[model samples]
Target chain A: MTVLVTGVGVVLPGGGRLADLGRTEAGSLEPVDPRSRINRRGLRYKDRATQLAFCAAEEALNDAGLYAPAAEAPVRAEIGIVVSSNFGNLDTVCRVTGTIGAEGTLAASPMDLPNASSNVIASSLAIRFGLAGANLMLCSGATSGLDALSWGRRLITAGRCRQVLVLGTEPDNETVREFTDTPRMLDGAVGVVLEDAGTAAARGAVPRLTLGTACRGGTLADCVAVLAAHGAPARWYPPEAVTADVLDGLFPGATRVDLAQVWGASSGALGVLQCAAAIGWFDGGGAGPVYAVTGGGRDSAAGHVFTAPPGVAR
Target chain B: MSAVIAGAGAVSSVGRSVDDIFTSLCGGRSGVGDLRVFDRTRYRAEHAYEMDDRPPGGPDVPLRTTRWLLAAIEQAARSGGLGDDLEGVPVLVGTGLRELRSVELRHRGAADIGPADLHFGPAVRERFGATEIHTLANACAASLSALALGADLLDAGEADAVVVAGTDMITESMFGLVERVSAVPPDRVRPFDRDRLGAVMGEGACAVVLRRSADARPALGVLRGVGINCDAYHVTAPSPAGMAAAMRQAYQRADRSPTETDLVMLHGTGTMLNDEAEATALTEVFGDRAGRPLMTAIKSMTGHTSGASGLLGLIVALRSLHTGAVPPTLGLENPVPEAAPLRIVTELVEGPSLSTAQINAFGFGGINAVAIVERAR
Candidate 1:
């Protein structure tokens, strides 16, 4: 029941073109037309969030090497899609509700109603890929994306699904304009494929070289203590903990990679960016356990322990 | 420890309590009527199922939806026979079409939208004194998904008890969307009926408490199994294949055949497409046994509560088990040919004490979820 991360896909700020996460400059999300990247027709109805998730899902599935139909004619593995977002479908909400509030309900666009759902982005991906398993969306806050990844692992380990496409999506919107105007918001989508260890090996896909840890119902200090027990994490990717400088005092020498430095401290897609960057660095031969922690409005923190597993060629 | 339903509560267009909704539904009462919450003269479909009792939020308080949610959650927690102090427990809330009323009020210069009231998680955290909260917005099936996730957490020994809730409010956008798509009934919602035109828009909130079976005292119903999947067929249309797969998955997870189940609570949105597709899915899953298990639809009276719809149906199932009689599916005078053979409970059907019942919740974006509840052993 060991759940392993096999592949990942990321769509970050600066228009989905990533020369490198570490070196990339932080800025608001640049325009990336999903129509050009999606290669599908009839996408005009879909919102930008859905399109971004679709684009990222495609890349992650391709990286996983298990996108082929599993014996069935067209049905894929009962792979579920779990998406996390703080401001999902806000643009659609603002536009639709605004129109209705102004000119009455008759003025609202019917097409916009469905797009204002937090889960539509996930369902959009499922419809395209034929993934007819459990579809869930977590809409807590910043750490929800990390919660989604941990929950994806649990879903696979519990035998609910053989595979799961875990995504964290946030599109540019006016709802959090002031926050983004400052330095705590970014928009885009990031995805990862979680699969069984045996399945990943059989598919000849190099697993996301690593180990990971998940714990719920703990304070910030407790979270760091739990991570401390696992042996001081080599590199840090802490989002909520950044408000407090205790991490530096605890593990001063560990190279702390500030995601805000790369993603403008935006809570929306920052954690996912941190995750993608950590995995990218791991895949690129960065050594030791890559620390990733996120805790937002909720009391508990979600932590991940990543290291290249022994004898696995990635 | 197994996840079990210890208590339940709901506030639909029909009634404010689980007993009120289920009893009214059992007695054949229709809640659909003219919309009084707002002006409906501009819309084609003027009638709707609106909440009679308004939550307390005038020019002073912001986020009317949060008030409704808190009321329903408090009611559910109390009715679950548990004490009021639910501090530090994990909370997962499924919400639909949020912030419309607040935004409208702000637009009208009536009240300023407070920061604490904007996010559902923080609102619930502050109101209930909860440390952890998660909001799920997956359309009508959100509550069922949240319940499924809570069950998973309980099964994994993550929490001793969890509160899963769903809430939605009747907004201009919701009603307008149905009218725009021509998915609104002219007068009343006739679920699975021959003359059923479309679904009627309605809104409400529902909450349920689940605790580890080993820990829950005097549990009412046990969470037997759950199966959730995306139709992947279309966003708004139902997929027979996906629906059948989900039903099959649920029964398999329960380690029992469909025949073993006693009753079914249907999504039955009253739309022609939804009813026919649901009938087709039942036939595909049950085969010759399609007509065996007695099924009932509550949406005829409850209307479609969007994200909160499934939990209202869950409450109905619990009441059926408790009363030992199935609630009647009002407005179902003539059954569709696709569902003729199946026992669509249009009348108050008396049977053996309900042992198990399955609830189906489907929504836009092809989101499908099934949850099985069984009488505690």
Candidate 2:
């Protein structure tokens, strides 16, 4: 089955559209007050992670022109929701626990419990959009984004759903001070509309990119070998361009793209930014097939092969 | 392309071994007890099913849940005839929402993700050298979601063998959330009982090893089919349509009718809305053929283990298939009449052989999951 990336929504520390986000000199996108981008009414109870994800979902749905299922025929069953985040709302958990511990259980805000889990973003999106499809919350730490997308693709191929909105939502909380302080950890939310090629073309939506096979649980060597086995291209597109002396041998003379330079280190959302970068490369007059490896400096490794959409003008 | 559950293990308040847990269930056991770790004098719903014994494993095993996981995996490997060497098997684990106790401190320091997420799946990957690891945090129904994914991976030939595990520990935050939500019952867990107040929050871990039927030998049960859906109606409330649709999809995938199912291991959280919605879903799926499959609520005894609740339910179902006895839904003497045409097994029944069973797991985020289990042919 041919799965096409129909639309994308990205919010990084760097300010730019998905296509223009790659400029090295571009600073990270600044945080907009959650109230500024979205309505505050139902937004008061939600955490920043949930708020960011909602913004991205709305943007992607609008981009895909599939924001409203009730408006169209062939009734859109709830869209499958898959989100990847590692401790998306650690602060909420802490505050809820601390508040209850200090005060009484009744004193704690009831709203915190619902948004405390990582899946809160996805579920909130579901309720916001009235999506009733299969929902999943993947927390593979750094590799969460790719794993999330992988699961979304699995849902579509397994005939479980026709389209899935795969998303990565991470917030910069004081609880994650260490990760944020780290050299490459940029915090943000990114989303994409993954639909069947037939579905996209039916709506006259042009495909932005095509996600290929994704594999996990492998070492770097193991990841490289598996990608090689899958006939993945020797060319590489990493979050950072400069390669270490050792990893250079994995993909000889591979042209590298530095996505983190502009977007910063977004953790699991890095995979989303990488996908956007790949789409940008092709959409900006580059060729097909970009191999990006996530979780290089973290736990586990996943290799995703994405190709430019067919027949898109250079 | 079928997925066979080769081996399974669990660590609960009753026991660590799956066989022992099954035995205890058959003998009419209640794992619910007092919460020991924290001072619960000020809190409501002080009782819960908790593991008092320390996690049994090497001192090197890092966290509380990680130790339980390693022990369960070892047992699963041994029972499944897969041996200790799991060279290429993929591991997927489902844990609770996040760390409940140390969420504040763990974050104030280095950007360490919470201890729960870090210590579980990553530990499995590092200790066992697992190439692939997936950590699902879909709240209570997460384990079932992982099981569904593992089955799909096995069927797609993407994995030769897959291990699916779910673990959660009782935490003050979780307890607070349970209390705040008014989900904890006044006294004991009494599923399908008219006098039932709410559910008792429980804690534990369960693991199951799965392989393609062609490759697996001496399998415990075949995971015939799995269906999952979200209510999208509310984050905390169950949607009857979503629940029924998921069960219907499971039966459709397995090409079997729900009426023919021998037994059903319900999520039966013992909460008001969950039980009511579940009963409605049951009626929607098995309309005229009601009062057929015996309904058993294991949470009435085990308490709700959150994410691991589904796997725990599956454990009970497998035991029922093995022994000719079905465990009674403890604490359910006065059954609710509204869920009529559905027979609640309030008493232990033996010799009523069952070859097929179903497990229903509904999470807080309106996630509904159902898995069909069948006796290996």
Tell me the DockQ of each model, to 2 decimals. Answer: 0.51, 0.57
Candidate 2 per-residue C-alpha lDDT over A12-99 given as tens digits, one digit per residue, 9 for 90 to 100:
6543567675466655456656566656666778887788888778778778877863223332454687888775776677677667
Q: lDDT tens string, model 1, B1-377?
A: 24678878788778878888877888888788877666556567767877756444422334666777888888877766555666668888886655555654554466566433444766676667776677777788888888888888888887888999988876655666777777444577777898898888777888998888544357768887777788876778888777777788778777767877788898899887899989889887888888888899888887888888888888788878877888888888889998887888888887667788889988888888888888777
Just chain B of model 2: what TM-score?
A: 0.92
TM-score of each: 0.92, 0.93
Candidate 1: docking tier:
medium
- Model 2: per-residue lDDT, tens digit, B1-377? 25788899898887778888887877789898776655565477678887766434321112566667778877887787767766688888877644443344343342244433453556776677676778888788888888999988977778878889888776666677777778544566888778888877777789899888645367788888889888777878888888888898788877788877999998898888888888888987888876889888888877888888898888779888877688888887766765767887888889987998989998877887899988876
Instruction: List chain A TM-scores, every candidate, in order.
Output: 0.89, 0.87
Chain B TM-score for candidate 1? 0.93
Minimum summed lDDT over a 10-residue window in model 1 chain A is located at A177-186
- The lDDT of model 2 is 0.75
